[model samples]
Target: MDKERIIHRICALHETCPGNIVTEKEAISPELIGLNIFGEPLVGFASATDELFEAFKNSDIVGPWFLSPTEWLPEAKTVISLFFPYTEAVKSANRKATTHPAAEWLHGRIEGQAYLLKLIESLKKWFDDNDIKTCVPITDQRFEVVVAGNNFKQYSCVTADTFSSNWSERHVAYIAGLGTFGLSKGLITEKGMAGRFISIIVSKELAADPRPYTGIYDHCNRCGACVKRCPAQAISLAEGKDHNLCGAWLSKMGNLFKPRYGCGLCQTGVPCESAIPRKRRT
Candidate 1:
């Protein structure tokens, strides 16, 4: 229906959704069984025809493979971006980790993702019941994600650079006035960088939110806290982030942690961990 109604429904679902809670049957450890992964989500809206979507297709950005909202759904009129910040339990646990990912963070990465899908699926169903058309691009049949060290020819779109996807939730969130990018390449919102982003395109037209700042990295204070927190050494004040190195380190984490691998060290102990950092004076 309207933005207020949409947000209310989402928050209600989050509060009552069993998938949002880590069940004993699925937890990797006893302590994680009752852990809640995400807090109340932040939602933002953007016009499906935003010019920024065209800019994202530039080679230096997401490349030609990046699909705009309308490309995903021809009748798309609004892009609803949702940021689900990790619960305090999840962030606090990960902050205690150094070289490897905390078990709590691992569950957040694996099971938390499953909950995201379920949340969106339920939301989509509600829209369908209301006679509104919606598309969850991440779960769409056309979605394409090229991971590092993986072949891409299997997909119609190919790029020499890996570690990218056709539908980037972060970029979409930025367009929705959700936040800006930090030095770590993580989108820093009012709720912070330690979270997951997902979006849906709908036929319903909604007023687009105004971006409070102009620059892509406006929310980032360039404090370099993420640099010190990075265990993979994948981030720096000068070069920002090296995706290859970050990807390799994640691969190593996969070998060590198996089905639940993740390294959010750059996200947890940073100045923008839970909120936008105040800009430092030069």
Candidate 2:
């Protein structure tokens, strides 16, 4: 299928999917029952043979655990990456809370992810119906994410200082021309940093989009707004983000919020929350 056709299908699904809306059973408040979780998604495609995918195998990047498109789907010809921005209701609610995650934001984190998985599955089925093979690496049975200090011997090569996964949506998004990394390590797209990313590798070959810029942090303005917004002080202009500290905070949030836990303070109330921050006027 053509890029336009794929995008149209995704948009239609986002518009009509019941999972996209917070239902009464899953909502934190009566007013939040119908809150939209994500805005229109931004889709980008990359050739499966892109050199950037190979580069990701390096230690500094995603490590040897990073799986290229071909590794996920042997005949993979294209990699489709999508960024689904959070709706204003979710962002605004999180902005109002300084230290803790708002109930709306928590739902966005939990329920929003549930919707994303369904969207991914739908896209996979679409490709299957088209007679094209596809694989969603993150959802694949082989996928694994090893946290620091975990006794996972097979992944000992991955250091304990950072979050390491067999497949990283943000990294794949960058290769697919979606966006660049922000100070808080969030992918900053034209629609901004507060969002979720999902990708699929398919046998269908689509023209890859041109990456508009060079350098990993080209879009980031180094505004440091995320640093000040982080309740865990996990972000800093001098050091960037500390995933360990951030993970600890999220764990603490689980104790307070239980099954639904998240803290997106660095994502909201920041210059890069909803759009790319403007560079210095001078």
Candidate 3:
């Protein structure tokens, strides 16, 4: 499909989609966020791991600037990263869930799972219709490839990890122009990082990645709210964060919420999100 028509179709999926923030731009972010949320396995995508799943369990192999990851993808030309600000954006913008149970991912419920898959099915049909050769996670194996080591966690590949690679989510999102970096090292979007979710789609034919939909980083330079609030002490004065600590902290908050899933420490209450001040509601 022509690029314009592809975007139009994505928009149509948004116009009549099941989830909230149905627009194409807002729907893709979670994929990247998922990439980020599970950062360990992604580094393996760059490096050739004898045990692809085990490499996902360890961050020891990750190299700086994705040198290993880049070397791994020999068949790529351009990668287009997409952003979907699902519930975080919804909450940040103070938009109510139009229906009964909330549709957000952070609540950790599988409620939105099937609806999201159908949305991606529409997207996949769009790509196939357009003749875009794509290579994201497919079937149960791709997702299992990442989280196979963890016996407790099991999610569908299509649930997220769309068009994934080894690079970190923040790096990909920054490359795509969807958001800026926060002191918490979260990708802060116009949705204030709270409401934002991220996804990635790579095309061998797209030539250049689309210019970032969010534009340049401006206010991000002045704020360190994420830094101030980080309880894990995982964040660095520079960039290196201890995911072990961050994950542990998020786990700490996970037990409190009696929701269908669990608590998302940084995702809940969301001082970092509310701090950004609301963008004018369209």
Give one digit per residue, the lDDT tens place, for model 1 in 128-164: 9998899999999999875533332222122245568
Instruction: Report the number of clashing residue pairs per model.
Output: 0, 0, 20
Measured with C-alpha atoms, the lDDT of residue 212 in candidate 2 is 85
How close to the true structure is residue 187 of candidate 3, measured as C-alpha lDDT? 60
Count of backbone collisions within predicted model 3: 20
TM-score of each model, in listed order: 0.94, 0.94, 0.54
Local distance difference test scores for all models: 0.87, 0.86, 0.39
Candidate 2 lDDT over 46-161, as tens digits, reads 99999988977766556777788999999999999999999999999999988999998999999999999998898888889999999999899989985534322321223356
> In model 1, where is the ten-residue run with the lowest total lDDT?
150-159
Which residue pairs show backbone clashes in model 1? none
Candidate scoring better on TM-score of 1 and 3: 1
**Candidate number that wins on lDDT, 2 or 3:** 2
